[model samples]
Target: MTERIVVVGAALLDGGRLLAARRSAPPELAGRWELPGGKVEKGEAPEAALVRELREELGVEAETVERVPGEWPLRSPYILQVWTARLRPGSPAARPLQDHDALRWLTPDDIWDVDWLDQDVPAVRETLTRFPTETR
Candidate 1:
C-alpha cells in the first residue's frame, strides 16, 4: 500500500464554539466549510504542523488539545487527522488570511449551519463527541 500523507485539521474552539472555514481555491473544494489546517511536512509532528498551519492560514497562535482519534481519506495519497485546538493566550483573533475566504464560529446547537465539505462531515461528527453538549 502507498504511504498516506497526513493533513492536520484544527477543531479550534473558543467560548464553546467551533471554528469553520470556507474554502476559496482549488475549485472543487471552494465554498465548502472545513476545519482550517494543512498538510504535515516531512519529519514534522502532526500537532506541530497544525500549529504552524493555523499561524499561516488563520493568523492565530494556537495549541492542540488532543487528537480526535480517527482518520478519513481525502483525495489520492492524503488522509485527514484532526486535533482539538484553542487560541493561545494573547494570540490575535483568527482571520481568513490565507486558503480561506471566510470563517465562522459555530455553537454546538448551530454546528450544522454551514455547508461542510462532504469529507469533513464525518470528521466533524467525531470531534463533537469530545465536547460536552451542555457546554455549548
Candidate 2:
C-alpha cells in the first residue's frame, strides 16, 4: 500500500498576493518556503484538515473555495492535496506555529526566489498560472 500523506494549504490572496511560509526544523527540507498548512490527521477529511491547519499555523479562519484538482508527490513519499481558500471575516493575524520560521506574501515572479518543497513546486506553479501577477 502506498503510504498516504495529505498536506492542507491555502492560497490566500492578501492585497492580491499569495502567502507562503518558511519552515523551521525536523521536517527534512526545513528552510524552504511552503504553503502554510500541514499533514492531514488519520480519519480527518482533507477540507476540515485545511481549516484546522490554517487556524493552527496562521491563526486564521479559511473557507475552501476549491481544491486545485490534482496531486503532487513529495520526495518523502506522500501525495499532496493543494486546496485554495478564502479568508473569513474573523480571521486572526498570522503567527508562526509549529515548524515555520516566517511568513511572506509573494507575487508570482517573486515566488521562484524562495526555495520550495519539491512536491509543492508544481502546485505553486499551477496556482501562479491561474492567478498571474499583475504587471506593474
Best by TM-score: 1
Q: Return the lDDT, model 2, position 39.
A: 83
Instruction: Give the worst 10-residue stretch by lDDT in candidate 2.
Output: 127-136
**Residue range 4-38, candidate 2, lDDT tens digits:** 78776776666557788888876787899888777
Which one wins on lDDT?
A: 1
Superposed on all Cα atoms, the candidates' RMSDs to the truth, in angstroms, are 1.0, 2.2
Clashes of each: 0, 0
In model 1, how many backbone clashes occur? Answer: 0
Span of 10 residues, lowest total lDDT, candidate 1: 127-136
- What's the TM for model 2? 0.87
lDDT of candidate 2? 0.78
Q: What is the TM-score of candidate 1?
A: 0.96
Could you tell me the C-alpha RMSD of candidate 2 in Å? 2.2
